[model samples]
Target: MLLEKINGPDDIKKLEISQLQTLADETRSALINKLSKAGGHQGPNLGVVELTVAIHYVFDSPKDKIVFDVSHQCYPHKILTGRKKAYLDEAHFHDVTGFTNPNESEHDMFIVGHTSTTVSLALGLAKGRDLNGRSENVIALIGDGSLSGGEALEALDYAGEYDRNLIIIVNDNDQSIAENHGGLYKTLKKLRETNGNAEDNLFRAMGLDYRYLEAGHDTAKLVELFESVKNIDHPIVLHIHTTKGKGLPYAEKDRERWHAGGPFNIEDGSPLYPYQGEENVIFSCLKELLDTNKNAIVLNAATPMGLGFVQGVREEYVKRGQFIDVGIAEENAVAMTSGIAKNGGTAVFGTFAPFFQRTYDQMSHDVCLNDSPATFLIMSPGVFGSDSNTHLALCDIQMFAHIPNLIYLAPSSNEEFVQMFRYATTQKQHPVAIRVVNTLRTTGVDDNTDYSVLKSKIEQSGSKIALIAVSGLLTMALEVAEKVKEQTGNDITVINPRFVSGVDEELLVSLKKDHRFVITIEDGELMGGYGQNIAAFYGDSDMRVRCYGISKAFHTEFKAEELLDQHGISVEKLTKEIIAALRSE
Candidate 1:
């Protein structure tokens, strides 16, 4: 096969123009074979196969750097860059991560998982090359979807005046993870319709030289375009239109569903493990709000599906102006939520916890400082969130807990989430953030506690020991209590601290009356986490305090339970430790 003969870009450069199509086809097949079984970025990688082949054929990588935005679309680039065995061989499939890693290959510029960062990263590479008087060309390959992000626009503005060998390729697939949003997409649509001859061009307006190609899948045309921009004196934008899922019929038809997923059937594209169709409590809550309150708005930053608002399910609310997707712009979404709240509208903005890193300034100044009373739901935080270091939000508590006027709530169960979400949306006091777990447990009993009164609920009151469990760790706390009872004939206290940002001072003070040792268990980082607040509260007292949480680091690819156990948070470990501490006393 063509791929078997080729190991790197040098092999591709040796191939004739007529043989390039065969290589591209082989690359696409390899991508399909691995993705169908192992499950990964299907649509994005498939669409970029031809473009990646052409790129390697035209330029000298490692020397001439190419930065892939998000790097989810780098599978084809990986295949052509001496890493094809990771895609072709089943044993080596797990050898490479889904994203670009500098440790794995010199060809990969950065280990990137987030979007809208390629332009800025590539600009830095260009500047460094210029400082050293190197003449190697630098390229930033970004998708049209990522263009709506604030960072991409900022970088593009900078690249406009950069007088060096910088090539910015806008892979216009007319999609982000979902359909593109913001006013910029309108200009992109016009440019695509006119075949890049549109008068009102966003790129050219930014002061960068522009070139357009409609056939992004044509390797011959892509190679010609790359050659034209190679070692150019001034920065330029090459806008090329390409299908998102070019080869697979089902994936091409439903671009969003096929973006990424679990293992799927190769022929029919049916999921190997089909979703059991569990009820989404968060979506139900949003729907109830939208139906009841006319002024209520639900907002997300490019990941509407994360909030249970999939394509068709969200369109109705969108037409009503109650659902808005800011399009990879989390900062804009947070600030907009604040503005909405200040204007007497009920605003709720939510996305995955990792993306909230971009909205720190807006959350602190625009929302919390102003006390807008907006509701922000941080989904899948700590160890329960994305396992990748690039996307892990291990320090979410560190980011949001200390912000003034922001009440960060941690709900332990589905009923608790319902009550807390309802209370947060209805309250007109301070801005509220709820740390939402991926899988929620049910207590069967409806939660009737008024969250307006911030206090921890004592689940099982006992003497000698108190386990103050935060959010998702509440179940483990109960298990520890049960285990201690079975072994030592003692019922240890289990307290569910619903609030993470602020400690329940009254309940904590009361714990000193009967409890000798106070143990705080949280799923986030140990430093500045919920546990530290508890530890600080008992700093001067004789009440011994032990804080349990993830250690501070960029932890990746770990099982949640094993990670907790490693941090001395397991039920058996905690039970034994508690028994020992009691005996010593």
Candidate 2:
């Protein structure tokens, strides 16, 4: 195969111009071959196959570094740069990560996952090369969708003024995770329609020289484009138009559906392994909330699909001015929610917990400080969320709970999540942020607990041992309590702290009366989490407090159950530890 012939950047550089297109073909085949079974950013990687080949064929990587924006398009780049085994062979499918990593290969520059960071990171590389008095072509390969980010805009502006060798490759596939948004995309569309000869070009207006190629999939043309601008004296924008999900028919027709997902059938693009869980509890509840509350507005930053607003359902709310997509900018969505609430409109903003990390300042200053009563649904937090350290939101509690005027609620079950979501949206007293239920288990009964007054629910009362489990860990706590009862015939008090932000001081103080031994368990990190607060409250008390949670570290690629067991949050481990603690006394 032509792909096998080319092992590294050197091999690609030695390849004849005629053989380059064949290599691009094999690279795309390899991308599809693995992605169909392993599943990843299928459309983004497939769209960039020819582009990836062209860059490696022209420029010397490691010397002339190219940084992929979100690293979603790096799969083709990986296949070309000596990592083809992971894609071409199913046995090695679990080898490489879905994103870029410097540790994996010298060819890979940074460990990137989030969007719109390439320009700034590439600028730093260029600046470093200049500082060391070394001359190397530093290239930033960003998507047209990433142009909406403030970092990309700021770096692009600075690049126009910096007199250095920087190449900005704008891979325009005309799609973000969903369809592209904002005023700039319209200008990009104009440029695409006009064959890049449009007047008042955005890049040119930013004082950067520009060139465009409508044939982004053509290997020969792409190589020629890169060769024409190699070692340029100033920064230039190479705008290349390509089709997202290029090789697949259904994927090309529906780009958003093919953007990223689980393993799928190569024949009809049907999911090989689909989610077998019941209908999402949060999505259904949110739909009900919108159906009833006319003034309520739900907002998300680019990831509307993940948060349960799919096309037909989303369009209905959009037409009603009840749902808005802020387009890959979380900071704006958060502050806007606060403004909407201040003006008498009911506002709720939700995004992935990892993405919400960027809005800490906005959530604190604009929303909480003003006490706007905006509701935020922090989705998939703690160990249950994304395992990537870049996207892991284990430290979410440290960011939120300490902030004044913000009430952060954590729900244990489906019913609890529904009730909490209702309370957060209805209450006008403080800014509320609810950590959405990660576990799919339901407690069966309707949750009638009053959240207006912050408190804990004690399921079973007992002396000597008290278990304070936070949110999703409530299930684990109950099992541990049952295990203790089965072993010692002593009922262990199980307390469910629905609200994670504050300690129910009255309830906590009352626990000290009967509970000689207190064990706190949470799904996130032990430090600055819900458990630690309980430990701190009992620091001076006669009660012995032991907080159980994952260590304060950047944990990645771990199974949910395995991570819980490692932290001694599992029923068996907790039961054994409790029995030992009791024996010591």
Query: Which candidate comes out best when scored by TM-score?
Result: 1
Please count the clashing residue pairs in each candidate, in the order shown.
0, 0
Question: Which pairs of residues clash in candidate 2, taking residues 3 or more apart in a chain or in different chains?
Answer: none
Taking the tens digit of each residue's C-alpha lDDT, what string does model 1 give over 308-395?
9998999999999999998999999999999999999999999999999999999999998899999999999988888888899989
Off by over 4 Å in 2: none
Residue 538 in model 1: lDDT:
89
The regions of model 1 sitting more than 4 angstroms off are none
- Model 2 per-residue lDDT at 63: 85
lDDT of each: 0.92, 0.88
lDDT of 2 by residue, 221-244 (tens): 999999999998889999999999
Error of 1 at 562 (Å): 1.6
